[model samples]
Target: MHASSRHGTVAAAAPARGGRGGRDRRPKRADAPDWAKPPARGKQRDFKNEQRAAGGAEKTRQDTPRATTSRSERGVRASEVLRAVAPRTSAKAFEDVSRGTTVLFDDPREVTLEEQLHYEREGHVCIRRAVEGVEMIPMVKAVTGEIIARRLEAYRHRVSVLCPDARTTELKDVEECKRALKKHSQEDVGFLQTFNLHRNESSPAREYIMSKQFAKIAAELMGCERARIYQSCVFVKEPGMAETNWHSDLNMVPLDTNDFVTLWIPLRSLDEDDAALHFANRSHRDFALPYWRTIEGMSDLEGRYEIDTYDELDLGDLTAHHGWALHWSPPQPKDSVPRYALSVCYFADGARRLETEELRRTPHAEDEWSYETWLRDLQPGAVAKHFELPIVWP
Candidate 1:
């Protein structure tokens, strides 16, 4: 018999004599602690002393001057994380910007005649809040009629629907929209990005923007020595357009003075539920500081009483593109409802250069605009096949 058979026989017989069977006996372990009679398979932990020593070493390193770096160096190191996440803009161009001077206008030959007229007029200042609860000026009103007419024509062609109201095309996707963006790097770069749609310039709607009539009108309303398209973008909110996180436009356009204005024309008159725009008043003047405790939960004027309520605003927070400006609605909604709005930014002809170096040095640099794209896409001669409004500045 094999040794196993002999052992098994002995164990079976021993169990009959007493409980001294080999299978019933427990083995003694020398590798176990007093409290733990049975040793576990893994090695014991050395956590106590090692952790304390490591923590002490880290603290010592932080305290020692030899291991310390200057705040500027520390800041650069911290920003490395964001630099990785953000789309790369030309960092080299901005590096020596202190010594760098921007040509006030890139080229004079490209400046349109309408821009010249507006440039002269912007110097002659006029400020008025006209109409019932709406700011209006006679100078701006005359040009608005033409703008309304052009907008109406554009809407009919694009949507294949008619809006027979006093309001016309608030949103326009003109032919030269892409080319215009190439000129002014002010609008979308770095953290700011935009999308556009194609529209034929041969349409009557396209003819109006190219006629210099719109530029003349914009100059009068904006009260700028010249008014030019800083950026042109089209945004559509379908039945389920994603809501935008609360942010500011000023963050996109680095400016010295708050003399800039944006005209938001909606293609359709929008209702409350169909995603209207929300804005804060005069918040642009002092945006270096916080405006609201939180953007959400703010509904009525009383809710924003902590902040000055002198500046009335539309929509509290239901829509995206919430900013310091007073918000308004777009024309149409998806369920045969229209909610279209055109946002055009115009800056004064002459404004002081704001020193952006200090602002860029701030801890939160994520929201800054990038000039890299502007340098790449901007081309003077590249005219859009359809240009409703020329972007040239005198």
Candidate 2:
């Protein structure tokens, strides 16, 4: 229930309620008083009030807006993309992601040496149309059903002074939620985030997050023989959500490894105004203990680094960045759709826990949570090989 930009409806506006159609079909002339006349040109009409004065109540469609998306339709959509959890027709596609040891590169998604080198030097790279149409359908359905459908009650757990709407009464849909939201807040008002979704029981996300194509790319980019997924997170920014502060993935992770990379997959296409993820080129080289931390405060550093972004990402397109690469997203434009994305963090299969002292050296807000969630089972010097952090590649 994090702040999430989502799909449509809720306003009494015509478009949302199927304008005109939601009203009585009887002739309007009959409802109008014989003495009443249309408002003069260049002015407006208060038809409802006039009707009331005329002793005619405008009849509206009785069904509430929430029922617009019929239960039958919702049922159909949920089942449609689930016929095959993994889109691949190959028998090899059926393994559980957690222990799926072999990365099947034979499916033709391997990265070229040149592409791998680009990542090595720039700390980030975009793979155009890395996923296909069928591949994205399930990804979207899984996220929308899990996040957006939960609505506003879940997003306001942390109130933001900037987003008064975050405290509004529970809303019916994405559009209504967006309208209620006042503005973006650096505190992440409109952005809904959930981590380890792949691990959720009866999850609809494992197929995409654990896709071997993604793992093979991670392995190639990290120059490792195998890769393990540390976590899979879904981030959705509702329209009107604010800019994210500059930060690095590794800065919040408790693992000790420079071999990490995160694959950011957009469920739909994106434009810059859609809250595109931006990165500081070559910034991974500057990352270490407290590298960007202890600064006066979080601020944009385009002047200090060569900031770059894809500006647009088609539905199948996704980007991967080094764990330590600095990145951020802009405030999403109000009228735009929610920006939905899935991010899977991977590392060499043998990644170990950060030294106890080093872990203590940095007071990352997530350290305690991370330890409680994934690292409590292993000692500091031990290779991270718990049930949750599975080896996703051979």
Best-fitting candidate, measured by lDDT? 2
Residue 355 lDDT in model 2?
Answer: 57
Clashing pairs in 2: 3-192, 5-238, 184-242
Q: Identify the runs in model 2 with alpha carbons over 4 angstroms from their true place.
A: 1-98, 101-106, 149-190, 287-293, 296-300, 360-371
> CA RMSD for every model?
31.1, 18.5
Q: List where candidate 1 sits over 4 angstroms from the true fold.
A: 1-217, 286-288, 291-302, 305-338, 351-356, 360-371, 375-394
Predicted structure 1: clash tally? 22
lDDT of 2 by residue, 53-160 (tens): 766333332122221111112221212112222222322223334465222233547687766776888688777656554456656777667676444533542232
CA lDDT scores, all candidates in order: 0.29, 0.57
User: In model 2, what lDDT does residue 145 have?
Assistant: 72
Error of 1 at 390 (Å): 6.1
